[model samples]
Target: MSEVLESTTTELTPGVRVPLIGLGTWPMAGEEAAAAVSRAIANGYRHIDTAENYGNEEDVGEGIRRSGIARQDIFITTKFNRDWHSREGVLTAFERSAHRLGVDYLDLFLVHWPNPAQGRFVEACEGLRQLADDGAIRAWGVSNFKPAHLRHVLDAGLTVPVNQVQVDPARGQPDQLAFHRQHGITTGAYSPLGRNGDFMASPAITGPARELGRTPGQIVLRWHVQQGRIATPKSASDARQRQNLDVFGFELTQEQLAAINALETGGPPRLDSDTFGH
Candidate 1:
């Protein structure tokens, strides 16, 4: 069945709006990844997320072509590693990624992580800002960045249009979310559903799933977008991909929303940005 799900967007700039739900391509490679991307675009997904670290930009580009969707109609996002954390290094990285993706311009490009120990993150942000101003990219951001790291970037007078972090009902980073709110940075939730189905059994999620007649995954993804946050959920199955993007047609009650928020266990994320980055 061919179905076009309505897309919802969050504005990162005056005119740039990112689709709230995106297809995340990670750990999937070669033709399988390409096929998945093609299927997702056909299923009404306008946003696609990839990273150099994922080693699938070439496949992703192939998938885009296979989808037969106009390049301008899709919002493509990709990230670079710490090695590209400099003014010139960032440009080089963008060129390489764009070339691999077979696109001359990108919708959004990001620093995959803040390698603070290297102390070049500030310069990296500078490079991203320059790219945005010159129209090489529509917008730029950082991922896995904590409040402390963001403060330094902010102090350096750089504009962070978005910050993609690991956020889910189980590991809700209230402090990090608050910091983003204070600084006007849009929160993009990677691993937004948590590891596996571990958190799906919580009453906070299951209760709403039962009440709303939706899957636990849908419940959690709805929670993210209802709060004006963006979520990129990875699913290779056609059925699962459709389910993930079919979150916009319903509304969750205040009680249900608060119940899900109450599931926070106050634990550290599986991957801490401080010590881990490529």
Candidate 2:
């Protein structure tokens, strides 16, 4: 039988379709990050997610340029840092990000975190609106945002295209997912594979991996896909990078999916929403 890599996509904004699976460049920098990105694109990933804070935008840009993929064929996402949440600061930060990425426009630009305490989210969002109006970014959204914060933004009449949050079998975000669904906003899962060092050792993952003849990593990835959330898994190893995107060829049975979902504890998020001083 031939292996089939399933391709899924969700539209966070009109005319902006981001692939369900993409490469996340976090904690990766320098030449290694660039080479990993190049390998991922060569291995069939069309979407790439990076952030100004990642400090790898230049390397990512180099990788994309070397991938031989047309700029239009790739969906690039970058974020505005927390410190740069002010109105004037946002434009300057975005311009710097674009310059580093070597791109005139970003497919999706997001607010890295909601620092409401700074009392600048509203103004920052307004800056994003201006960028959208100027055609500098094709779409704009937020990451690590809670429902209350999202409501505040919406109440301000700012339409967010998507909300990128931490979602995985171990940390199911049903409320966040529902909120996005209710508001016509797409949800992106940043760490679909629970950062648990022993994620594969868990019965929740291993059991399904056994049934599907796949690795626990693949099982976790498929679970994210089966749940209909966009996921970006990060890896520096070429083998792991390939394994991360190798999720397309198999289908997890409903029973297997339920087994994985049953592992949800609604526990603390893997990423720190409060660390950014929001």
Candidate 3:
């Protein structure tokens, strides 16, 4: 399986594209992260999304090296940890990630969260800008950012081309998606399947899964891709990883798409950025 040819991509900028589907490695580390990444790569995954908070950068890098693919042939994205959200903190944190990943350059770097209470995310992105200019990073973005947070990044003079956030069956985030469209940023969904095992039980998702001859998860994942959002679903299993990437052969009807989207009930309030994290 040549994942390079089998996968599709979303444009992050002119001439720069990240795979529409990427292998997400969270809640995984050490040997576990290494095994999953190497297997995903061998089974046809060219893009991998990791984070400093995940504590598995070295494992991810080792997995990449084990895949026998050149660094340029793969698209890797990792985020700066929340502890290092300052301008200088970003540079130092990035250095740690790069060193751990054993790569001289990162395909994409993101501020892991917009902890507005900390008040340094804007400067973090500005530091990422300098990194991009210095050729230390290819592109930069933010994760878990809300509309107001995006404005801060933009106001700080950063033109981030991507924003990684939670957009699943139950968290469509229409307003945030609209904001992304208005500002020319692409939305990258962290979990295509809704949380709390709600993904499997949702008729909105399963109905389409049966009719379309795909898994419920596939229906939800495809929905995100069809709507032009980069969907990164995490699984430690190689089979599941490949299944997540194999959704281009079919699409959901507009009605099916809308129905699944209607499952959105504003998501859990805990996940809301206002009370999320510090």
Tell me the whole-model lDDT of each prediction, alpha carbons only: 0.92, 0.84, 0.85
Lowest-lDDT window of 10 residues in candidate 2?
A: 1-10
Per-residue error at 276 for model 1, in Å? Answer: 0.9
Superior candidate under TM-score, 1 versus 3: 1
Question: Model 1: how far is 278 from its true place, Å?
Answer: 1.0
Model 2: per-residue lDDT, tens digit, 64-137? 99998999999999987878887788889889999999998899888988877777777788888888888888
Q: Residue 56 of candidate 2: its Cα lDDT?
A: 94
Superposed model 3: Cα runs more than 4 Å off: 1-7, 268-270
Candidate closest to the true structure, highest TM-score: 1
C-alpha TM-scores of all predictions:
0.97, 0.91, 0.93
Question: In model 2, how large is the Cα lDDT of residue 22?
Answer: 93
lDDT of 3 by residue, 153-185 (tens): 888667879998888877778888999999999
The collision pairs in model 2 are 4-249, 5-248, 6-248
After superposing candidate 1, which stretches have Cα over 4 Å from the reference? 1-7
Per-residue lDDT of candidate 1, residues 99-183 (tens digit):
9999999999999989889989989999999999999999999999999999999999887889999999989999999999999
On a 0 to 100 scale, what is the lDDT of residue 173 in model 2?
Answer: 76
Question: Which predicted model would earn the best lDDT?
Answer: 1
Rank the models by TM-score, top first.
1, 3, 2
